[model samples]
Target: MSAPISDISGEHKVYLRFLGKARHFLFNLRSFNLTPAEPIPAAATKAVEVSVALGCAVNGTAQPSDIAAAVKMASQADVALVFVGVDQAIGAEGHDRSHIGLPGVQSDLIKAVLAANPRTVLVISSNAPVAINWEQENVPAIVGGIFAGQEQGHAIADVLFGDYNPAGKITTTWYASVDDLPHFHDYDVRKGRTYMYYQGKPLYPFGHGLSYTTFEYANLEVTASALKPQKAVGIALSITNTGRIAGDEIVQFYVHVNGSKVQRPIKQLVDFARVHLEPGETKTVSFALGHDDQALKYWDEAQQDFVQEPGKIDILVGASSADIRLKGAVNLMV
Candidate 1:
């Protein structure tokens, strides 16, 4: 067995101190938890003895060499958890990465470690997706964690230990390759962008997530001969969890307009909701369709904002963008 390692380092202590002060000013709440965990595995313990790493590598404290050494140590360990991700490169608001690959020498380090020890369970900590070139066949499990809240570390540990079931879904598409994307840069622009306008396919479509528990949908209802301007319609369905574990389900609503005056997307996501359900539990999920959501919003060259056009519309409710479980039709009068 390896000797016990210090929970917090001298450097981390200073950072935590500053964080404590900042929290006091921001929330008027000074009680904060910044305790660190003891290092496991002798190799990891030794690596920490050499350098007191910080939260992010961009601050010039944790260098490439430090990360490489840590990866090397982790690869040799017989641990069930292997956390790998960018500390600051991908998650920052204005810090969009040029490539989806892991930053700096992190990718290379991961490749080397996996090649040496193929059985290690990989947990990818990232707000956005990253590319993994290795054969996933060797890896049994892959967990993608969004920038979880302040209890992220503890929450992840609990999930791994089966203390909590993962019910979250991916709101954005996860492309197999950046090349597989449809003009990623322009996808967010006002003129014909986003998954609705994109032509190509994504690896994982929007509203994609796996639950330990399974669910079934039935009894779809839609009321409206025509979707009139400024009018609302009703849609309802029954959802039940079939698996043993309790989980949350997210119901997504999409609209496909027909015979439009202007160009429109193949399907547009108008509304979504997440519900918690126990095993064998059944509940009815309902959504009210508003005129603004059903109507087509287009940017007129002469005018500004989005203008709604009168046309026929089809309402779709389903698990994902590609999977429309139920469908209904409505016509909008000008």
Candidate 2:
């Protein structure tokens, strides 16, 4: 194919400009070319092609006939997979969404399809989180297909099947509705912005995800019951995969100050370790807390600089904040 007709900037001026943009954008990791891709390796011998039907549009009027056709296609299939979510047009950078539902009649389409086939998987492919309360209640599975570029479909398919044991956790809190979220203008995370500060029950709390396999925690140990300003304290815990498949577990460490004079988050994540374990395999993960890790400092109004306050803090470890399993306390000695 021929290139776009340019006013003699050069024969390949457009290509040169593209290369320059690619060089700079590669550093930010926000953009990539998916037109060129390496051939995907062989799939499972039993793998078969699945049909996807999209009759919902964000800007157009809802068509009953389109929904009827999709339902007919779904009724014959073993399972239905719906890829519905906000896109660049609805949710984008330097812009704010007016509402947080599935963008438009996409939610309506989801309901219609569910009426025909309850064995539906709602795959959300958006940059921002949207309400999925209805689907979560009725659908068999919900896949968070965050804008994963060109190979997005392949990645989604891999997870939908048993080929990939996804252990990735959500980074932010997912609410049941827009009403559950804080005011859009409130930029302060302390004002119920994230899992660390949010007060209400979230649809899916931060750091929440399920693996194909299961892991059990045991033998939690803390090296010291007291903390010195310059001394180091260690915390160790054992994790075992008690399921049939192998997977990775992110061991999160959070600390809650028992008594504090200044405002603080409910619990702050100080450290984390990602450990991969096979079936029935066990591994001990450990983390250390030194001056930088345990030294809690807050901006002092009376004083000009940040000041450290000595207090007792509880060490909590688990897969997620809502799943804390082990607990230990250490008195901070200044």
Candidate 3:
């Protein structure tokens, strides 16, 4: 590499500098030696390789093809795992994406492969959400590998082979399409941003994930029916693993103000807990939230401060924001 990589400076310069630093670090770690660039060695020898062919060029220009060879291969295979996603070139910290669909004809390739192989798994590796409404409806299974980094292959392999039970949930709302969103420059989240304010149904809501096993929520309890200012209350619930295998369940807690003078979010996440359970085993999870909890406070533009208004606060507990299973309420005294 040489100096003066770019005439630009500041953040863009910092983003560019990482390339040089990463090159050096990777070389030092013996991962690569690009100085005298040699063909990288294959990680495995026993793995069979197939060339189904991509449906597009690197520049995202679609090139539709017969894809007979790929379809034939998929039809004969026991199961087909179609990997598709965007790269840093398509999405990064410095810029915004133009659209959310699978780049070029990747979606087309997926559809063809899926038609031939019903036992198909759609594995997506991306930094952000992708619009795959068709895949969601038709694909047998889908795995979201959001920028899992270097060891992602091993992680995915373990989960696919049943050696690991994935319980990780999506952190953000995955909208069904780009049309479901407000303008990019709209800084006001109230206009429809995030799980808190978005009104439409999403492809996948926040905190959505499926475990290898199933669990049941029960015995929800709220310690206080009324709360004083700067005071806290305890919330508890019981969860039982009712399936054949052991797995983890993430219990989410959310709140909604029954009646407020000003506009408020539909629902807001307050706290969460994760528990591991064996088949037929049960565990109790609990959380604490004070009247002054930051999550319960709303910004007051006139006062230039955050405040918790006096009202009925509805408590919701469940697997995800959209999967509430228990309900309770408490009054915040004026």
How many clashing pairs per prediction, in order?
A: 2, 0, 0
Provide the global lDDT of candidate 3 against the true structure.
Answer: 0.79
> Where does the lowest 10-residue lDDT sum fall in candidate 1?
11-20
Q: In candidate 2, which residue pairs get closer than 3 Å at backbone N, Cα or C atoms, i.e. clash?
A: none
Residue-level lDDT of model 2, residues 1-334, one tens digit each, is 1233433222231111122233212112343322322344476356455675666765324578777778888888888877777655665656568877776678778887787888888887776788878888888888886646646656787899877888878887888778877788878888887777888888888777778899999998989888887887899999999999999999988888767776677888888898999999999999987755633556688888776667788888988878898998888777
RMSD list, candidates in order: 7.2, 6.8, 8.7
Ranking by lDDT: 3, 2, 1
Worst 10-residue stretch by lDDT in candidate 2?
9-18
> Residue 251: error of model 1 in Å?
1.1
In terms of lDDT, the best-performing candidate is 3
Better of 1 and 2 by lDDT: 2
Which 10 consecutive residues of model 3 have the lowest summed lDDT? 9-18
lDDT of each: 0.65, 0.75, 0.79
Cα displacement (Å) at residue 198, model 1: 2.3
Clashing pairs in 1: 226-331, 227-331
* TM-score of each model, in listed order: 0.71, 0.83, 0.83
Question: What are the per-residue Cα lDDT tens digits for candidate 3 across 1-334?
Answer: 2243335322221111113234212112223221332334586456445345544542255534545556677888888888777766676666568998888777877888899989998888776789999999999899878867656767897888788888888999999999899988888888888999999999999999999999899998999989887688999999999999889999999999867877788889998888999999999999987878876778899999987788899899999889999999888875
